[model samples]
Target: MAEVDTEINGYIVPKNSQIFVNKWTIGRDSNIWSNPDSFDPERFLKREIDIRGQGFDLIPSGSGKRMCPGFPLATRMVPLMVETMIHNFNWKPKKGMKPEEVDVSEKFGVALQKAVPLKAIPIKL
Candidate 1:
């Protein structure tokens, strides 16, 4: 229980602080991430770090015992969905668009989402 206590305290705001600091903001801080605004998945692959909501460096879901249980389910589902899609077909952008031009801008809410829904051509192979 002590281990859990310490971890929770590490993330908690000071009692007297008036400002509300969102954990998500800290996780995605520009100072912490190089080219933070860029959607560089490679940066994560190059490092041994993970963003399963722990390790402080990345906590998209959160950290510690209170961390989201749905995280594990998401971890499994996301790659599976991507794999299923890729295995079934080929992906490409529109005639005039490049993959890089495929707008990746995000909108935040209870769940994060792309500002514009992704437009892709999935060719049945």
Candidate 2:
């Protein structure tokens, strides 16, 4: 809530007014991320931002002051889960489809979900 009448980015915000931030828009903001709509996990390796560890809550689970109770377990498990999968198998798109042709479109609502369920075949190593 706003503490007093103030303007933010030119819009007047009255005191006591409740405020909500749209994390979806912020996550896709071109100014904040290049090729924001594209899936690029490598983007994170390119820059340093204080968006974790109670600094800023952005992305899955939680961080910092608003950190989730399961953070400790999740931090250890999620990575192991990912690494285990990558280590054991090679993921491939459905037969007859090109990698670039796979749909990565998302349906935005309360939470973002893939428009189409991703169908990939996992080949055992």
- lDDT for 124 in candidate 2 is 100
Task: Score each candidate by Cα lDDT.
Answer: 0.74, 0.74
Model 2, which residues run further than 4 Å from truth?
Answer: 1-19, 53-59, 62-67, 111-125
List model 1 lDDT by residue over 1-125, tens digit each. Answer: 13222224467544444443377677578888888777877888777777765477777777766578898799999999999999999989989998989987768766566999999999999
What TM-score goes with each of the models? 0.62, 0.62
Clashes of 1: 1
- Local accuracy of candidate 2 as per-residue lDDT tens digits, 16-90: 875655666767878778898888889888877654454342445445455567777887898899999999999
Q: How close is candidate 1 to the true structure, as a TM-score?
A: 0.62
Cα miss at 37, model 2 (Å)?
A: 1.1
Residue 85 in candidate 2, Cα distance off native in Å: 0.6
**lDDT comparing candidate 2 with the true structure:** 0.74
